[model samples]
Target: MSLRPVVDEHECALHGDCAEVAPQVFRIDDVAVVIGTGPDELIMAAAESCPSVAISVIDESTGEQVYP
Candidate 1:
């Protein structure tokens, strides 16, 4: 299944860890943004790596949260 990544702008600290872990999926500007759809593994990794826990991965089909 595919996963979609989202960044919580309020919680984001501009740490850039998410982008570092999954550059193809995340980009950092004034804040982090989802640049592309990523595989579940990569999305989870990026979400887990977020220092502020600002990233989340959701299952596209089930709408279930896959990562914190």
Candidate 2:
């Protein structure tokens, strides 16, 4: 299954950890951000690595996140 990256601009600190983990997926698009394709594990890592917890992941098939 595939996943999408939901970035919380408010909580994001632009730490670049997500970009580091998955450059192809996350990157610094100007002062803001941009993300690309990935899976749950990569998505989770990117989200968890965010010190501000600005990144969120939602499974496409299941249509669920790390929430209810």
* C-alpha lDDT score of every prediction, in listed order: 0.88, 0.74
Worst 10 residues of 2 by lDDT: 28-37
lDDT of 2 by residue, 1-68 (tens): 77778887877777888888877788866433655686668777877788777887777788878621
List model 1 lDDT by residue over 10-59, tens digit each: 99999999999999988899899888876778888889999899987888
TM-score of each: 0.91, 0.79
Poorly placed runs, candidate 1 (over 4 Å): none
Model 2 collision count: 0
Pairing residues by index, what is the TM-score of model 1?
Answer: 0.91
Clashes of each: 0, 0
Error of 1 at 29 (Å): 0.9
